[model samples]
Target: MLSFNILYSQERNVYDENIFVNCQNEKLNWKKLELNSTEYKYTLISKNYFASDKDVNYYNGLIILPIDKNEENKNVIEELLKLISIEEDLFEITAIKKCEIQKLYYSSFLTEEQKIEVKNNVIGKLRLGIKN
Candidate 1:
């Protein structure tokens, strides 16, 4: 498991290099986002554990999740989202999206032709074909 370390120190507020994505068909990768000023790290710990593609269930806002059960990670997640703009070095130029996240997630980390599959997935481009 690669660590992005978006949160670091006791404050849990920092970024580390080589933050890889989870692109396996059986594993999931998650990230941070802010909605209604509430922070959430979109990890496989959400509600989409039993479904896929057309059968997948989105959050209350049509957002998909895998575990969706960590209430305490809210504010910390939001702060992580905010870190994108604060630290340009936090994430790749495309994946972070200037900190405007909407249902943030992606696949595993794989580098091909100098392009990362996970980064492409995060960018919402390239057809990895694996859905949900």
Candidate 2:
């Protein structure tokens, strides 16, 4: 069971990191902000992007939920999304796009070899979930 858990975690990490790399390629300027919460120590992967009008600055990204021993991924993500939606409504946010990437990278984090490695390792999964 322990080994299976470790394998699952590793796969998830690869998926997450591949998304991060793809975000960098798109010039989204992603950032990981620390949420001020007492219940969970989760990091928010946010990105600053311009709207179609180029007047309003929109923020969107994923909530990096911690691995809980008791809860499944689907449950945890759903609960977190609900909480975020409530907060967004309170704050009048326009939309919520769920995804994760750390730091606003104006430059590439992956080397030439590393890029090839990621492409080979998870070619099918290398996509940023953002639509615009």
Among all candidates shown, the one with the greatest TM-score: 2
TM-score computed on alpha carbons, candidate 1: 0.21
Query: Pairing residues by index, what is the TM-score of model 2?
Result: 0.32
RMSD vs true structure, all candidates: 15.6, 13.0
Looking at model 1, how many pairs of residues clash? 13
Q: Model 2: which residue pairs collide?
A: 62-99
Error of 2 at 5 (Å): 34
Worst 10 residues of 1 by lDDT: 122-131
lDDT computed for candidate 1: 0.29
Report the lDDT tens digits of candidate 1 across residue range 1-132: 211112111112221112332233334345665556855443322121222356332221111222222456444444543453243233212222222222223222334521332332222111111123
- lDDT per residue for candidate 2 within 1-132, as digits (tens), equals 000000012123343444455554442222222233535333333443324323333333333444332334445444543454444332222222332222222125555543443332211111112222
Alpha carbon deviation, residue 1, candidate 2 (Å) = 44
Regions of model 1 farther than 4 Å from truth: 1-69, 89-132
Candidate 2 regions exceeding 4 Å error are 1-38, 54-56, 68-71, 88-132
